[model samples]
Every structure is written in structure tokens, then in C-alpha cells.
Target chain A: MTLEITGLKVSLGGRDILRGVDLHLEKGRVHGLAGESGSGKTMTGLAVLGLLPHGARATGRIDLGGRDLLTLPPRELNKVRGGQVAMVFQDPATSLHPMLSVGRQLTEHMRHHLGLGRAEARARAVELLGKVRIPGAEEAYGRFPHQFSGGMRQRIAIAIALACSPRVLIADEPTTALDVTVQAGVLRLLRGLCDELGLAVLLVTHDLGVMSAIADEVSVMKDGLVVETGPRGQVLREPAHAYTRSLLDALPGEPGGPAEPGGKA
Target chain B: MSNTASGKTPLPGRGPEQARARRRGAHPLARFLVRRLLTAVLLAWGITLVTFVLTNLVPGDPVAANLGQRALGDPAIVAQWRAEHGLDKPLWEQYALHLQGLLQGDFGTSQQSHRPVAQDLAEFVPATLELAGAAILVSLVLGVGFGVLAALRRDRLSDHLLRVLSLVGISVPTFWLALVAFYVFFYRLQITPGSGRVDPALGGAPPVTGLQTIDALLAGRWDIFASAAGHLITPTLVLALYTIGLLTRFTRSAVLEVLGQDYVRAARAKGLPGRVILFRYVLRSALVPIITVAGLAFGSLLSGTVLVEAIFAWPGIGQYAYKSATTLDLPAVMGVGLVVGVVYLVINLIVDVLYGVIDPRVRLQ
Candidate 1:
């Protein structure tokens, strides 16, 4: 397993938020964590990255390549944050720094993680933007985050996550804040990038439709614990858990078939 | 306060009438200003009423003090003078007179100099403003720099030490700080020219403007302003010290709050380094609150100019107010007080407008 989380416990404001959560993931695979609102889906991702809100308490074993992420010191955790693992957030709109040029934001990681000098970092940033298929990557470098459209910004957010070529990428409701049409595009982009970059993805969202697009393995969570786990195709065809069945029933996918061009599933 | 620029609405559902009502309720900038001005006036009125009453309530007639030994026998003259200044009426009537004079821009005259108080203020206002401007510049540079440092190293000893320093600054008496600054800079170091800007060698300025710095600059006598700046250094340092502490504390806390926000964490997770997360993501949002506090602090510094000016023997409004207050020059005091109050109002108004310029959300609200 590339990433394994076992018996995770999280409490905040004297109330248990996550309880005895266990999960395992293979390399270069996408695992969809499906849950309702306040079902600890987001908190589970945060615990992995050590990004909890104020006054939250966490315990139990979370190992990313045997690093013991939960017990790692802040400095080591910081090293892991943008190096081995990175996260894309729900609201891509607000996830970026507003004032800085795209170039400045994109190059910063290269400098910190790779220890690249300014010239090399800038060159690499433009290359990364090009990989994300951002038109006029050189010009886009000068543009601020606000200049991009919602979908384009998500692409840039994805580009940033790929900068360090991290092994594991945790996306917390990555498409929840986007429009339905844009959500599919982002999911497709994430799926393509995972194959190209050779990385593992932890998809945390309540949207079943989004899960079906990119998720290889699916895990259904209810009340802070995983209730079911199976292959994405099998889970969608025949959900074992009641919550999983309900989640699929709740989502009314596009009337005819999937939205992919030339290949309808 | 902010007003909407983009026509697109964030909220999907609202009837036309309700939206219109929301729009008319008061732009955030306008509301912030209205609240601040109302608060300023209420505080100003209370302070004025207390100061006026307390100064009078102290067992002595200001008119009698004005007349010196001649006050006892010249009852007719005293009554005439009282009626002319509209002081012969009840205490409330006197307040009404003061208010009326204030609204009309007629602050009356200094009884001592027999000079119109408004005219006298105009003569020295420019000079004091120049000095205050210099002090504010110094405070902003030092304060923002220290604040950025403290925030970058949050939870470290430097952050803790800076917080303690700001606490000390807030607690220390302004006048006492001024005294200590003077004794150390003037009495011991003797590096400065000591009091009031310019040497006699500069020959009372070029008279192009009341401000020594400007007059010196206009005449291409950079040397004179340079010397004046030297003299100004110590007092300006003293003037800015407390404000620096205040701004640093506010900025550090504000930046930390922004850093902890989800958006900043997202940026960091994007493989963007700490510098990017801090300067671009965190500090930009943090600036709104920091700028607000900085504006209020700037206004307070303008108001507090009196003590530092007096301590340094600088020719400024505070010194002028003090001279007028000590001599029971009611007209002079009321005039200076009104001007000071208006200055504070204007400063805060500008600050409010700045919010609209910085954040579109604030403008929309």
C-alpha cells in the first residue's frame, strides 16, 4: 500500500468528529471517499495532511510510506506537505493567492521542494503550465489568479499540485464548489494527470457522479466511519452498503450516458 | 466601506424590491463612515462638555482671570465682555454658542493675543502637519516591517517578545514616554539640535511656506531641512514608538489569522512555498484589518501631537492648544478643539474610502 490510514480518531470542541477510521490505497490509483455533509470525509483528508482547524485533537496511526504522518514533527510534516503529498481544495476560486502573479505562485514550490534557483524555477513553472494545456503559458505566468475563469483556475490549481510530482494527492471536495459541467472537466483532467504523473489520489467528496468519472476504488463513509469498500464499477453497479446505494440513487447522472466525448460509458 | 462594482450578484434569490432596499440601506463604506463619525462626534461632545465644564467648575471666573487685578471693580466691562462673547447666559447657552461657532467655521479669537483663533491655527497648522506626516511615515515603515517579521516567525520568541513590547507601549503614559525620550536623546546624546526645527543660521526660513521642510526645499536649502530633520528625529521617534507597537501587534495577529484560513492552506498544498503563501495569499487578505487599525492609529497620532510637541518644544497644534488651555482662553480652546475633531473625522473618512479601494467584497456590501 502506498498510503494506509488505520484506526484514526479525531475529536474537536470535545466532540468526536472521526472514529476508528481505516483505509488502504495502492500507488497510481484513485480512491473515492463518498460521504454526506459532516460525515468526516473532509476531516479524514485534513488529518492525513495535519491541517486541522483550531482546537481539534487527533490520534491513531496514519502512515504514508511508513513516515507515521500523525506523529511526525512540524518541520518533517512541512517537508512531506508539498513534497511527497499535496492537496487540491474544494474552492479553487479562493484557493490561490490573489495578489501574486501566476508565475510567482507556481515557481515557489519548485524553489522550496527542489531548491531550484529563480531562473530554473521560472522556466519550470512555464513548462508545468504548458503541461496543464494553459494556452500561452508564458503570458499566463504574468496573469494573476483572478484573471482566469473558474475551470481554468482549477486547471492551474491542478498544475500547482503536479509541480513537485508528489506520490499522493488528496483532493477535498475538489469539484463540489464548481459547476456540474466544469466538475467533469476537472475530474477528467485529474484522471489524465494521475496516469501521466504516476501518482495516487484520494478523492473526498459527496458527489457520486464525480466519483464514477475518476475513482478506481470507492469507499462509502457514514458517521465518521467507512461502511463499505469495493471497486468503483462494482460499487456503482451493486452497492453493498445502504448509504452507498442511497448516494447513487440521490445522484441523477446526465440522462443518456457519461459526458465524455467519443467514449460513452 | 465598499460599494458594488461588478453587476453580477453572488446571492441567487432576492426580489427586486428587497434588492433595492438592500442597496439603499447604506453602502458598507457609507455605513462604516456614518457609524465612525457619529461615534467620533459623540466622543468629542462628551469630552468637550466635560473639559469645558470642569475648567469652569474650578472655583475661578475666567473673565476675572483675564482682567487680572482690574477684574473686581470693572463690573460693567466684565458684563459687556461676557455679553459680547455670549458667556453672560446659562452654561447650556454657552455650549450652544460654542457649537454654533464651530458649525460656522468661526472659532473666535485668543483673548491673550486678541487674534482670531482660526487665523492663528492656519498660520501654524501647516508646520505641525508636516511634522506629523514625517512621524507617520517613520511609524508605518518600522511597524509594518516588524509586523511581517513577527508573523513569519509566529509562536517563536521574537513573536512573544514583540507582543510584550506592544503591551508595554499600550500601558505606558504618553507624557511620561515623551519625557524619557527627551532626557535620553537631548540631555545625554546631544546629537539633535534639541528643540523646534531649524537653526538661527537658516534665518527664520525662506517664508515660501510655513513648513520648515517645504521652505527649505523650495529655496534649494536642503541643508536647512536636513538640520531641521535632525532636530525632528528624536521627537518623531518618540511620537511613533507607541504606534509602531500597536501596528505590529495588529498586523501580526491579522496575518496569522489569514495564514490559518483555508485558502492559504490550499495555496501551500499547491506546492507554493511559504513566502508565496504568506505574501500573496495571507498578507493580501490580512491588509484589510491591518489598514483599518493603522488608519485609526494614524488619527490618534494626529490627535496626540500635543504632548510630543510640548515636550520637544516643537511649534505645533498641541503646543498651541496647551498654551490656550492653561490661560483659560475659551475661544482659543474651543476653536482648536473643533479643528482637531474635524481632522480626526477626515482621517477616518479617508480610511473608510480605502476599504472600498482594496476589497471588492467590502465595496459590494
Candidate 2:
């Protein structure tokens, strides 16, 4: 399944946050949404998931697997959420319900969307945890989110998003809160999941390095508008937009050292 | 590798040694319970002592109050009465005697009615409990319901209306509200029966339960039960309005806070229905504060029944305490104080235990 968002616009409190954003994601690929803070990257992700805050109005088309999410009723939209599409938030510490056990949180989406019984949901929860490479998945199920490390918690969040076999996964800065080493592991895990499950991932982040690490295709957003988008290697080597070049220049260490970024020396 | 790495990090004070130490000792909850129980006992004792001292310190001679004008004319008779009642003894000696009587389940005697304080409390405490319990039930249902509604419809007309209504409910004095309720519901509408527990025409039930509604029901006197419940309605409503307003405000703020949390958004993004999200995630998270407020509101309602009982002529501890205060019945006043203290302690304990149940973090701590 492919996730396509076209001409997405969002306004909050009479102020336009997202002017006109567009992006596309295909199965078995990672689409990086790279932008600076307040560039509407997160807003685009929220609009796609229908998770905009109160008094915020969104317009335009959000097509997920041939369904127009922007036009879908809330009841139908809910069926699409976590069933056809799911999201992993930036801060995993706050993403999972603090009071609930990991197992319960993982199984809740599956049980609600798939109408799976307790036994079936529990089995799938364990399986999802294992897929996320959480050691001792069965024991980890009974543990709360606080018991896990930052990287582990993000993996659990990903596991929950994957519980119902969603076609599209919106990972909003999934590694931003982790250590550098943990970031690589999470990025690698997401990359592996995209290939293994043929999952189309909308990886929203402000870090161009992250995009270089895993994104197959990249879209550069600035002021709620997509400035440039193309295959990652081509976009990085010969950027059409000057803003993309500056963003690459702003990355730490050597500025514009080589066309191939995120490569270890 | 992740597990081994995490395990290798020294947890500082949370290692296996500490876990073993915890295993050998009483559980945290057990220790907490024991500590709370001890505090409750000490608090109850302090309340009794304070009540005893304050009552004694009040300007007036218990002997003269009891003996009327006769004791004023004869010093010998006054002395005799004081000695007989142990009032002539040292204050500490009298306190010791009071404690001795309390240990034996004695609450002294009412000066006005010449009845044992214990007996009067037995008759009155249950009535107040019944009234406060019913009032709390009303408050919980209406307050929590309106609170959630206001939160969900935040900044809307319905929210504004509920906020104004709760403000009015909270601001209006209980006595005035009770009178208005009586005038409107009983006199004008004729929907509810007049005051007192039940109609004197129905005689009385066997007093098996002390609570008129309960005893009447137990005795199979539906007419008496209906009449008693009807009389209870105005007073209960009058008492409940304050708590309803308080709880509504509390619950609204609590729910609003929880609704803003990231987990609530996650729940919504998970495709869970709005109703399920509200109840399961939002309301459940908000319950800690609501429960704390509820327990406190109930405690205040128990003590606040004085004006409501006086206005409605409900035969509850508040009315009895008021009567005892006017008559300088120190024993009865102290007895009421002791019971109220114990009731407050018990309610707080229940609230704490409920906190553990609602939030596992509290229980684990």
C-alpha cells in the first residue's frame, strides 16, 4: 500500500501552520520528511493521522490505500487508524501509556482493530515484541514502559504501531530522544521492518543525518511547503533547492565534505 | 546485548542486594498501612484531648449548668455536684477518668437529656452517615458527569452554563438552600414530604438499623420508607450541591489535564473510539485527584450537615451536636468530635487505599 498526502494545509487559531505540503510513500521504502523546527513536518504527520489539536483545521487529500482520509467520517477514520496506518511518536517515554504494562499497550490496538480475543491478542503482542528485538518478550510484556531504556521504549512503541499489521507507519522523530549509538540501532530496526513487512514509513525528522542513514526517498520541507524532493542520493549530491544545501551545510563536523553523507569514515 | 548492557550498569541503591533486603522486610504497602494506622490512633487521641480541654475551658460551670438556679443559691450543693461528676478533681485526673471511660466504650452522659453520650451517638451517627452517603453518591454522579461534559465541551456554551451553575451551587449557603428547597419542593410543589425522619402518623419502625429509611424497609413498611426517603431528599440535595460543585470543578480540571497528555493523543491515534479513550484512558488517569476530592468532600459533608439538619429538622448528629452545644452538653460535644475525627481518618485511609488501586505507581511505591 502507498500513503499519499497531497496539498495538505492546516491552520491553528486562525494562523496557517501548514501552507501546502505534499508527500508520497510506497511499500518497502522509507520516505524521509526533513525539515527544521516549526517547518510543518510534524503537522503533516499529525494531519495524516487525524491527530491535530483542537481549533486546528486541516484541508486537502490524505490517501491511504485508496481511502480518502480527509473525507472519511470519524468512525471510519478510526478504523483506518492503527488498522491500516499507525504512528510512533518522538518521545517514547510519553508515547506509551505510563500506567499500563507494555503487553497491554501492545495488544490494545490489535484487540480493538482486529477484534482479537485476549489469548490471540496476547500471542500477537509477544510476537510483535519479539519482532522489535526486545529480549525476553514474554517477560517484558508485563513490565511498564518506565522499566525499559529509551531505545527499548521506542522499539516498544514501534511494536505497538505494528501490532495490527498497519500498511503505513508514521515515525515522528523515533530516534531523536535516543543516544547516538541507540539511534543507529533504531534506524536500522525501522529499515529492517520496512523491508521485512513491506511497510511504507513516513519518517518525520529535523535531522538530515537521519534521512541520509535510512531514507530511500526524501522530501525537504520549509515553512510548511515541500521545497525539494527526490531519490535520497540524488537530492543529497545535487540538490535542486538552495535551502536543502544550507541544511546539509548546517550538519555538524565538516560542512559539505562529500556528496555521500551519513557514511562512516 | 541490550539486556546485558542495561544489567551491567550499576542501578545505585536498586541492585539485587536491595531487592533481597526488601524481600526480608515488610512490604512497603504493609509498612505504610501500619504507619497510617498508628497516625490515625494518635490523631483520634489528640482530637479527644483537644475536645475535652476546649469544652472544659468554655466559660460556664458544668455544675451550675446542670443544677440550674438551685446550685447558684447553695455552694454546698454545687460542691457536691462537682465532686460527684469528678469535676472538682484535678484536670489531669479528670482527663485520666475520661480516657478510662473511653477505653471501656463509655462516652459520659448528656447534660441536657440525662442520656448516655454513647446512646445518643448510636441514634444520631447513623442518620448523618446515611445522609452524607446519599449526598456523596449524588455528588459523585452529577459532579463527575458534568465535569467530563464541561471538559469535552470546553469553551462552549454548555461548559459555560455548567461552570456558572456549579458556581451558584457552591456559593449558596446550605441553610438557605434547604429552606428554599423545602418551600419549593414541599410547600409549593407538594412533591416531597415535610421534615423529620418520617410521619409521626406512621409511628416508628423497630429501630433495628437506626437509619429510618433502612429500618422502615427492613420492617416491610413501604409507606414509612417512602415517607422517610421523601423527607431525606431536600436535605440530601442541599448538602450534595456544594460537593457536586466542588467535584465538578475538580474533575473538569483533572480530565482536562489528562486529555492534554501525550498518551491520550496516542490512545486517540490508536483508533480507539472517543468514548473509550475518555473513559479508559482520560477518566482513569484523572481518578486520583477526583477520589481525593471526593473523600475530603464526604468528610466535610459529614461535619457540614449541622445547618442542613437544623433547617430540615433531620434527626442527625449535626442537629444533636448543635443542641448539645446550646445546652453546654460537654460530654455530647466531645463524643461528636471523637466520632467525626474517627470518620475522617477512616475515609482518608479508604481514599489512600483506593489511590493504590487506581494508580499502580502509588501501590508500587
In terms of TM-score, the best-performing candidate is: 2
Q: Give stretches of model 1 more than 4 Å off.
A: A252-265, B1-249, B270-280, B317-365
Task: Residues B201-291, candidate 2: write the lDDT tens digits.
Answer: 9887888878888999899999999888888888888999999999999999999999999899888889998888887889888988999
Note the chain A TM-score of all models in turn: 0.94, 0.96
Interface RMSD of each: 9.8, 4.5
Indicate the TM-score of model 1.
Answer: 0.64
Candidate with maximal DockQ: 2
Pairs clashing in candidate 1?
Answer: B1-B29, B2-B29, B2-B362, B2-B363, B3-B363, B306-B318
**Candidate 2 residue lDDT tens string, A76-193:** 9999889988999999988888778888888877888899999999998999887888877887887677777788889899999998899999999888877665777788889999
Quote the lDDT for A134 in model 1.
Answer: 71
Lowest summed lDDT over 10 consecutive residues: which window, candidate 1 chain B?
B1-10
RMSD per candidate (Å) reads 9.2, 3.2
Model 2 chain A worst lDDT window (10 residues): A256-265
For model 1, chain A alone compared with the true chain A gives a TM-score of 0.94
